[model samples]
Target: MNIEVSTLAHSMLADLHNNNNNYGKAIPGHIPRVPPNIRNINRAAYDPKVLSIGPYHHGKPGLQAMEDHKKRYLREFLTYMPGELEKLEKLNSLIYSVRTLEEKLLSLYNQPLNIERDDFIKMIVLDGCFILRLLIKIRVRLESEADAIFEVVPLLRRDLLLLENQLPFFILEKLYELIPKPNSIQPFPTLKEMAFAYLTMKLSTDPIALNNLEAYHLLHFYDLILLPKPRDHLIFESNQNAPSTVPQASKQEEPGIKITAKKADNFLEVPFVEGKLQISCLEIKDVAIPIFRNLIAFEQCCPTAGNHLTDTRFMDLMV
Candidate 1:
């Protein structure tokens, strides 16, 4: 019943936040905006005009068609990457603001711990997660927008500074050659191994102690950037002794994956089907980026905080 009580309180708080701004009275005149750093970068990339004219892609004597296909493929990437870059810019701005964090997150930082250090690390991890997801969305869009090439340039120009600023940290600078935006920024050194490095630099706390406590949370994404290939394919071979990557599934249950979850009377759901990973909780809003993603939980309540006990024993039984 702890879940029931938390759900009830969350409903009430959400109602207040949506219908009324009444609680701002408790702490008025606080910092209202949190702008992220935006670094401006000058374009310094291979002139695509020259590459197109070269025999390899620009109709070199006998390989005109091959060059044409090459141009078409690279140009497609150019079209969609720009808009994704803009989303990244907006994302950078949103994570710096406290008002966007969930109520549970607010309580997490406000607890008995030294508030500032915890807050700083939380901000960095949260911000990095936003940028990483933005890139993922861009990859998805590029495939769908293959026929449209006109929209990419403006998007890149708008976020060029933000992208350049973040590249050194993400260590994706080498991709600059592959995705070299014509007339965009110069090559630069990468800030590889940032999260652990940052933690070490601020070693006021014990190393073993910090690592032990951070195991799970750090497990989620500390080295996500360092992964060998940022993208991977979930491929399957077709019949007739030929290799084929199935696009749509042949049978609903053939994927052999099972997912389970509990439901409430009116609100709970069990939505998965034959061959799909149905993510029902994700709803993207068109702001600086989505203000939130999935849910997170808090624990170990104290009586001095004037809270009553919740019936969470049922959850323990499942274990």
Candidate 2:
């Protein structure tokens, strides 16, 4: 028994060394599930309640209702494909394209999925097509035309924003590339614009500032718009002498302190100036905490995602 155990250990160590030599330099593909201890704080925020977007929660019991809706959306989407091929032909072509990308897509996640290869490809196609349709609907203000499930656009939007309920951005982009553009002379909105429209549906401010489109997923893009880039020059040299307590609005009306809003390149970047109190154009709704919590989880799991740690820590200080 001892000799058999020793042989197995030696074989496992050899395999580990071989794998490391082949893939040690590769970047992690998928953000990990939230650590158990941290997830205990608010597990619901990390899990999807309405619909599943990717392989993570693909065939869960409660989310089965949306499966038919996703098929309907995919069918509608294929009708808009550039060629005149039959729907089955187009569908088969799409599945083949995604299948070709199977290995590459698998490399994007941190953990290996236990689903079958065909099931994984189907999930990617269905989720990617569903997202494209939703984005197009938002672009044209077609919520009124939505079916029963999407009548509550807010709920669908919330489901899409959940961390585990996400497909990589590239999958959506590839599917988008397959669709034919509108024949109208007017320019069509990009996927990012449509996403920003859905995310900031309740806000009155313009959503045109998200120019950098290099995001891993929708949640990452939302984080890019929500957090401000650091500005070292804005910090005062003599901060030790500054007052910690903020004055009330009525008290600041006197001549001693001046109140003004800073002009910033983007809404998130707005900061207070030196003369008096500065009110930034921040929009914090009830959904803010859970959204940030899941985004922080993503950053923690994937180090390749930029320094969200520093940004989250700074927000903690403000609190």
Best by lDDT: 2
TM value for model 1:
0.17
* Count of clashing residue pairs in every prediction: 7, 5
lDDT of 1 by residue, 226-257 (tens): 12221223323453353323223223235674
C-alpha lDDT of residue 279 in model 2: 49
lDDT of 2: 0.69
Model 1 deviation from the true structure expressed as Cα RMSD, one decimal place: 25.3
Mark the 10 consecutive residues where model 1 has the least summed lDDT. Answer: 290-299
lDDT value, residue 34 of candidate 2: 62
Q: Model 1, stretches more than 4 Å misplaced?
A: 1-105, 108-110, 115-128, 131-135, 138-319
Task: State candidate 2's TM-score.
Answer: 0.75
For candidate 1, give the lDDT: 0.29
User: What are the lDDT figures for the candidates, one per model?
Assistant: 0.29, 0.69
Give per-residue CA lDDT, model 2, range 1-319, as digits (tens): 6999999999999887655422223354463456677689888877776788887788999888889988988877666565656667778877888988888787765455679988899999988888888777666754456467656576677677766777788777777777544555257777777777778663324435564557778877776666666698766577456554544655666766666666554555645556565545556575566676777776766577666443544444443
